[model samples]
Target: MASVAINMDENSIRGDHIASSMIDSELHECVRQGNIDDFKSRVQTHSAENLVTPCGNTLLHVAVSYGSDKIIAYLTEECPSLITTQNSQKDTVLHLAAREGKDSYAIKSLVESNPSVLRMTNEKGNTPLHDAVIKGKKKLSIFLASTDPEVAYYNNKYGRSPLYLAVEKGNKKGILDDLLKSGASIPIKIEDGDALPKGKSPVHAAIERRDKDILVKIEKEKPELLRLSEKELGNSLHYASSIGFLEGVQFLLQKFQEGAYERDSEGNYPIHLACKSHSVDVVKEYLDKFPYPKEFLNNKGQNILHVAAENGKHRVVRYILAHQKSTLVKPLLNATDKDGNTPLHLAACYGQPLASFLLLLDNRVDRLIVNNKNSTPYDLAAEISRRAEEEYAKTDEMTAVERKQIDSKNSIPADEIKGKEADTNKIGGDYFGVVISLAILYFHACPKKSLFERFPVIKRPRPLRGEEMKSLLGNLLVAAVLVAGVTFAGAIQLPQLRDQRHELNSTSRNSSHENLLYGYLFLDLGALSTSLVAALMLLWATFNYPKFQIPAVVLSTAMVCLAIVMMFGAFFCSVKIALLGSHGGFLAVTIIVVAVMFFLYLASLVFPWIIPLSVNQILLQVVLHYYYYIYFFLFDYSKWWLTHKLYDLKTKFSCY
Candidate 1:
């Protein structure tokens, strides 16, 4: 990077002489034009050979920048010294050619003429090899790296090696392979057999890029890099788990078994990170792989469940309790952290009602256990609610004071303030309602208290009429029979072509497409089996637990939607196999099935909202409302018309 060093006295004199020599515009003109005949004539006439440019670049720099191969060949053969001379930016001819990435031929001539130019660096301390990798010039990167192992060993000012740059690119075309085939040494392995550099980890760059191939290449070449942790980010597994890369996490755990339990400096295990990410699948995989330390704690003495609960991961909390054996998870429900806070305690402290409710529902939970601060889950929840109320009140007070000030200054309308207050409370009302629920639950210390036990049973609602019940049962039967018949047909009629007939059938020469047809057949049979189970559940719900009619209906509806998705997925796969013999076709079909299935599920959810509006007007006067409002019959309907007897209609609705 050092410029041509000269004494202070002759600096200006040399600058003037160089500037005068570089002013010969005609000599440099022929280089840009790439006129080999004109360049040869100019070289013979005058000493235009090595005059420096304004930026200390020779005529060779311009020719290389413009990528004129003919001019470059003539210059390299005549003025070979231009290959070694440094420009003002300290880039030699090779650096310029590699950085531009326009012509690999120009770069080759410079490297072949003066191989020592390989070591020359620019002002940024990046050699031509660094330039090649940074710009994703595969040919130049391979050439420099294969030329010398030391070339790949060089790092820039940012401590980024050439290999790091290539990995960061995440190129799909085997750029890492080319670098490895060259003499390029992997930058991760330090001397004394250490993998870390006592600085930032370059491996993290590849993880951030999500380039699994680069990671695999590094692991294959030098498996030690996979073992090393990012100084601040933990091991490779921790990094992968943090980002919810299930494939990356799975790969790391398979290759490096020790990394599963490897905690970062913060005492976070791989499960701790996966829990932090709120990825239930990864957490499940970790539990399945390494079931030990069922109640693993982090630096804060927080169990994985505690982490999930505190972070508002509702599904993760439920999964832990549901998926694992009850004996192992029973103790975790009340396990205390360093501050004597259990999972429920943290959930209460964080004002998570769903989490608090779920935990308290467990019969095994001893709600009487007090924390280090002598506060039970209920007490903590109440305290959190109070603090939140105080904060909310404080915010309101500030807003009110400002409003008073504005009113005094501008004298705005009084109605506006009232309307704005009403609008603003709608938001505060939502969170405030949560706080109230938590406070109310604190006294009972039981969330699974039945609806009749929690509140006085008003009158029981009237049952549906015979017509309505019959219609509901009829619709359920129709849907169940339709799904069952379709799936049964699919299972029996499934076929796989055995012979190869290019002209007669779609499955001609390609063996892969034939496998796809068989896969679709399996999918169709499985869907049919699930559809049969769903139909039986609907029948059980209809005949037996009529009291739990709504829940049974919702469950049956969900299963029916799932059956539709699976059946349609099989159909779409068959269509794609018949038309396009490609795996990408399956992906496109799967997307269509997902979108259609989501729309169907959405319609099921919206039906509740739409049906009530349409029924509200007509339903009140129909046969259903007559039974609902007729609480007491003072006089018989046949006798009332004959005798004109008066009766008192006391209640608007009556349930029997």
Candidate 2:
């Protein structure tokens, strides 16, 4: 009997809870359906505050969610206590009304009932004004801001205030204007929650977006914000200058002239950054406004010209040289940094060809100026190139080691390793092996003055300028690179090399076959080495060293010519090897064709030098000397042959 009595009491309490929940759902539904009479009737039976949804929202919150202005007004008037009630998201009725942005009547009812709710923030710390502005509801935002302007400066959990969001969203409506006029303080650090350590400001955003119109408003209303600077991005002008925002830079300069002199945390002035961006107009503007650009050096003691040259801004370099007067230009051209390096040194060390060319074009530029390291511009360029080559060699070796480690981890079979070794040995005997052998032999036997030095056609290197230098050097570099690639490909992938390797390794390895293989390897290695050296010399010429330029062109030209000759010899050798065991008639035919092609190629090279001989008188003497010099360098190697040829040529041309 006791247990039955207890169960009945538990059932009674459960019935009451269910009955109360049904009443609350009906009351909230009446609000959602905009039925004021039904909600009023339901509220008479239960306290409106006690009648709450599962999300802790009162009838007023429900009315706001459905955008029913009449029901909302009725709820605020009758159930005044429900005005400040919040939901699960901590959003008051006003917060919901502001987010809807479509119903101004509902918003005004909520604000007029309890104006303090206008500043009430949700879970994200955003006030009603923040939601209105973020929703782009211009009229609603203006109303909310006017009701309580202090909320405009209330930063949310993300540290973005209403005014910051308005400006950042590029809201051209009266919302931003009203916020500014209401005296909302511009935020100093608007955190974007990004990966960057730096935070940005509203003014920085405007400058970054290049919204000059928005900037103008901020300038007029919040003039103090123009002076604000971030830690990483610097001030408004610094940010604008870095990105080459021309209008922003100009506007900032016109509004805040002091910003041009301010440096970023990295110690770079606005003009220095402008030069880095290659903004010639901005650079000119800075120079025009500021009396002395030379004094505006960065932390590195580098001026605008130094920055421009180091960054390869050639047009800026050119513009500065051409537009500025000699009084200003001379100082800049000759100005040395803290390291004692002039602009020319920076240009050369950074390997900026066009910038180096423009700098060296100026007569006032002191080319002999040395840096703190006691190295001239030419010496620095050489050193930098040497370091680059060494670094490349190190990277190559590291890559090889990594590949070997990966292969070892994979546990390749023993037979595969033996096969790979065979391939390696074959490659060695075919290409690099021949290269090493010939390199050692030639170096050991070479005379102090190379045999080519005895020839008269190989003239001394002379300085070239302007288009002539650009054209000749560019062509030489291209040809050298192409020949190098072809020779490298030929060395590794020739089918005859594999067959030759097989024959050399087998018991039937003929001495004749060995000789032929060596001959092919010699020709291929010669072509590869000469082309590679030619490319190296051409790259050195890009440093714009005058002495190196002419010599680079001359030497690269000779090297390329020699590479072509060796390439042809290698091609013929490959064909001969391929036709080794074939009929004598086929071998004879291949030889004839290759020989004819070789002579034609030679004629093509020799004809150009001879064509200029019959042209003009002044050109005739130069052409004759150059032609014989080239001819002797290419063909006549015997010392006696060179001496007799030079004597005959000198005697014949004595009258001229």
Candidate 3:
């Protein structure tokens, strides 16, 4: 009987608790619908804290969300402590009012009731003013900013103060004015944050936007901000110059010429950054305004020309060369840096083919000058290429050896390889073994100190002279244009063929035939696109400053090769479509013919690269044993034709 009575008492308490929850839910409904009488009756029985929503939203928070003026007034008048109640996101009623309020009247009344909530930050450290500005509540933003102006200075967890938002995202100039007028200052740095402006000022933000009007206004209102510089960004001028913002560069220089003299933490001046980023206009403007500063050297002891040449800033290099008549800039053509390297030496060391080509074109540049390492530009280029080739050989040899080992292990199961015959077959198994055999045969024919040193017939790689490059690239451009024109004509006629096929037998259209048509279209389109791009790249190389000459030429070559492959594929597809309903034997014969031709063409291209690629595999083994026999084995016929044979014949016999 005692245990039964205890269970009955527990059941009764549980029933009362559920009834109280239902009543609280009903009061929340009344708050949502603005049923004032129902809310007042239900509120008489519960404490103010008990009327909160499940998400910790007080009745006042619900009222603000529903925009219920009457309930808000009643709550503020009766239970004023609910005014500061924060929800799950730590958003007070004032935060919701500022973000979702239709007008500023409710926000004004809430702030009037409790002014301290205006400065209160939510979970994201965003105050009511931040919400107002972020939500584009212009009137509310003005009121909040003017009411407690210092609140705008409080940065959110993202390190964006209200002033930064107004410049970066707010689009409203009046809001910026009000904030600035109300003592809302933009901090130069947000301490210990990883985001930008950790040391950057608001001027950096404005300059990034390229709004000259905003810059002018900031200068007028607060001139000291123009002087504030960041360690990473240097200053507003450095950021602008680095990104090649012409208008921003103009405004910053016009307003404060002294900014041009300041250097970043990396010891690079604004002009150095401008040249490195290939901002030719910015470079010209700086040189025009301040002529003497053009010769200033950076931390690397590199002048503007050295920086431009090393970075492959071809346009800037051209401009500097054009201005060589100026006494202040002429010496930069051959200026030496800390490594005793001239601009040409740095360009060659870094393998900037375009800059090196441009430097070589000028008669004033001294190519014979050597660096501290006792290497001229030509010598450095040769050495770098040789090292690169050796590295490539090592990598290829390691990969081939590793692959062979893996194949040997995986070739036969443990139970299947029980005899020596299996091991012998695995040793000379396939095409890879044949390649290795040929490589060894070739390696033994002319053993030497090294492959490169032994190859006297193969000349060192050198940059083409300017006119030579122009002529070569011009011929390539012509080939690309011809291929582009052919493919374009094919593409234009392809749709007519489809239309004719469709009209001839609409009911007999097979999905297989349609697939072939699509394949033809795809191949033709690919050929056309690659050819056009190749043409454009070659044109840019020959005509423009050729900032990316080597890459452009290499890419154009690959594109042209791909275009030829696709063109042949397209021809095969067209033949298949035209002979779709023909006899089976005839169709098979035609496809076989095309396949033979395609393979023959591919073999022509593939066979030349096979031996040279395989030689790298046996280099280490051959170089270790045969150090005395030095001779050129693989003769480079193309190199001889380009360098010696053709030129020799042209000079020796006029018509031959």
The models' CA-based lDDT, in order, is: 0.66, 0.71, 0.70
Q: Flag regions of model 2 displaced more than 4 Å.
A: 1-25, 40-59, 70-92, 102-106, 112-125, 156-160, 185-199, 399-656
Query: Could you give candidate 2's per-residue lDDT for residues 482-510 as a string of tens digits?
Result: 99999899888656476665644444445
Clashing pairs in 1: none
TM-score per model over all chains: 0.53, 0.56, 0.57
Candidate 2 achieves a global lDDT of 0.71
| Model 1 whole-model lDDT (C-alpha atoms) | 0.66
Candidate 3 local lDDT, residue 244: 91
Model 1 residue 121 CA deviation (Å) reads: 5.5
Question: Candidate 2 — which pairs collide?
Answer: 457-629
TM-score of 3: 0.57
Clashes, model 3: 0
Model 3 spans > 4 angstroms off:
1-25, 35-37, 77-84, 102-106, 112-116, 185-201, 229-232, 390-656
Task: Assess the local accuracy of residue 334 in candidate 3 as a C-alpha lDDT between 0 and 100.
Answer: 78
lDDT of 3 by residue, 493-513 (tens): 887668657644544545556
In candidate 1, stretches whose alpha carbon ends up further than 4 angstroms from where it belongs are 1-24, 34-57, 68-92, 102-106, 112-127, 150-161, 184-215, 388-656
